[model samples]
Target: MAIKITGFYQLPHQTMPELVDFDEVFDTSFMRKYTRFRTFEKFLQGSRLKIENQRDFEALPEEKMDAWVRKATKFSSWQEMLDTATDKYVMHKNM
Candidate 1:
């Protein structure tokens, strides 16, 4: 079977976003285990910000996006969310 998986990553000092590929099984399992949303798209929708796609989501003001994330998720900021997600992904991968 062929599987495709992709995600975005940004470092603390980086101005550019990086595209990263993940294992399909691991990604699906991680999301199911850790987050309320089944997929990142659902997570964005949970913000109730009318984000139809990555472009729409990117066009949102940073402050507004951060506010929505904070309200919708337990993380206080987007970076925190990313950090936690990364940490959990690695932890699960090691198990």
Candidate 2:
């Protein structure tokens, strides 16, 4: 079966929502396993970082967010998490 992964975030001042790249990178199972949250919105909530909207999300300190992601998921960075998850998913799917 093929799956299409997609997620969007809209800023309060924007008329249209924008695609979130990481959310399109993998399936929900890996997302849930690594982040313990089903969606990015939920992940933000789990972080306890007070990111209630797009502006808040954008306002977050990059280094701090990276550190939190690393600590929460045991990955070096969000890119690493996505890469690892994709790799693992491919390996499992082929088995």
Error of 1 at 95 (Å): 6.7
Q: Rate the local accuracy (lDDT) of all candidates.
A: 0.62, 0.62
Model 1, backbone clash pairs (residues 3+ apart or across chains), number: 0
Residue ranges of candidate 2 with Cα displaced over 4 Å: 1-27, 82-95
Assess candidate 1 and give its TM-score to the true structure: 0.56
For candidate 2, lDDT tens digit of each residue in 1-95? 11223446453555897674544445577667676677655666678776766666667787778887887776788668755865664465456
What does the lDDT come to for candidate 2?
0.62
> CA RMSD for every model?
6.2, 9.7
Q: Write the per-residue lDDT of candidate 1 for residues 11-73, one digit (tens) a residue.
A: 444698667654432365555665576766566657777666555656778788779767766
Error of 2 at 55 (Å): 1.1
* Model 2 per-residue lDDT at 71: 71
